[model samples]
Target: MRRVLTALLLTSLLPLIAQAQSYSHTPPGHTGLGGMIGNPSGLSLKVYGTDPASFTAYDFLLAYDLDRFFFFSLHGLYERPLPDSPLNYFLGPGALLGVREGSSHANEMVLGLSANLGINFFTERFEVFLQVTPRLHLIPETEGDIGGGIGLRYYFGSQ
Candidate 1:
């Protein structure tokens, strides 16, 4: 029975594996649109730009969170490409602004400083990423929270 199940699973996954192998890791350009799912997660949009001196891409992220209440953030990240690989790691600073509500409490505007880190996998015009971000709230109260998510984005330029 185990052998039968394993064979069936592999057979089903063959097409997906083949497709993944056919995709190239070269990025087409600098901008993309996508969405993320996880703690305090929502829509994610990212842009990549090159620094003239290092000729490496830096990442900027804008994301909106709609869990329990609505909130948004903007982040600037320095990205490092892993040598001889299509994966890159990024970390940086950001700011978060949002409003929170509770049945017994008044609506409060939340503000914080945030740190973000993530790894990205690139295939042609697409990226798959995983990220963890921590925020230190400094306004309307003081608190901290850590959140992470997985995301996918499609580049807007040529492949």
Candidate 2:
């Protein structure tokens, strides 16, 4: 079931991810601030290892949902542009910590690992991306989940 859903999602995004041409541009800035709306959705912060033409970055996300549970995740990502276009793809491993309400009015700490796969289309001042993440919960119990979303980010200071 999970695999089917993931395949369906990637299929839907493939058309969008593949359309880019005629440009040779590097990523524009050192940091980006954005919001993602998805299975775990909220504020997103992206910071690069190098200011101008970074090939690596860190992604931080904080979200609240599932009847008010809080979630946090951090990803160390390797990002690279596609030779002559502003479109980039990234993949990485990440860790997640979440607080959720359990049965009997108790709260549980959820720990998980996630694999991120995504593509970004960069303009002069902003980036639009589509991402898919597969997550494995290892604490409280073992479970699996599929997560992703379409997001937009605005660069800071310089373009």
Candidate 3:
């Protein structure tokens, strides 16, 4: 009776162990902290077609990928993404707290809201994406405009 019971227990545990080993080789989900570096470029204009201007800039972003395609980012953006593909795109609404250094106006705190849309490609350790974002600057009294750039993202966690 002891021998039979021991054999049954081992047999029951084998499937569970094999399942764990199989999943161990697969990559985990995108729900963790990650960092992105990219260039940003787009059009800027005041509300109601006031003071329309265009600028090119660079940006660095720190964000969390909520899933395979969705992300929430806190980015220091300088340019916007290009508008070509609409299905595979990147876009989000975020606030900007920074200065426009080279403008004719004095350097001051600028508050802005932005939305981006782009596509993402993922590898084992990194992700590359392109997106376009439009921003509205409130404090500096600049018109809201569209911007986007190519971005590279690196993931740090278990594979």
Each model's RMSD to truth, in Å? 6.7, 4.7, 20.3
lDDT of 2 by residue, 1-159 (tens): 544754676577566556634123334347889987666678888887765354488888887744556889989888877776667788899999998888777999999999888988766656677788898989989998887876777778764
Residues 1-159, model 1: lDDT tens digits? 533653575466445444663332334236878877666557777766555444234444445444455677878776767776656787888888887875666787888999889877666677777789999988888988887777777888776
Distance (Å) between predicted and true CA of 45, model 2?
0.4
Off by over 4 Å in 2: 1-29, 51-55, 65-68, 83-85
Which digits, one per residue and each the tens of the lDDT, describe model 3 over residues 1-159? Answer: 533653575466445433432211113232222333222322221111112252121233433221111222243322232354211333345666555543454555556777655555444544444566666767767777554554444455566
Best-fitting candidate, scored by TM-score: 2
Give the Cα-based TM-score of candidate 3 against the true structure.
0.47
Q: What is the lDDT of residue 108 in candidate 1?
A: 79
Candidate 3: residue 116 lDDT (0-100)? 57
Give TM per candidate.
Answer: 0.74, 0.76, 0.47
Clashing pairs in 2: none
| Better-scoring candidate (TM-score), 1 or 3 | 1
Score candidate 2 by lDDT: 0.75
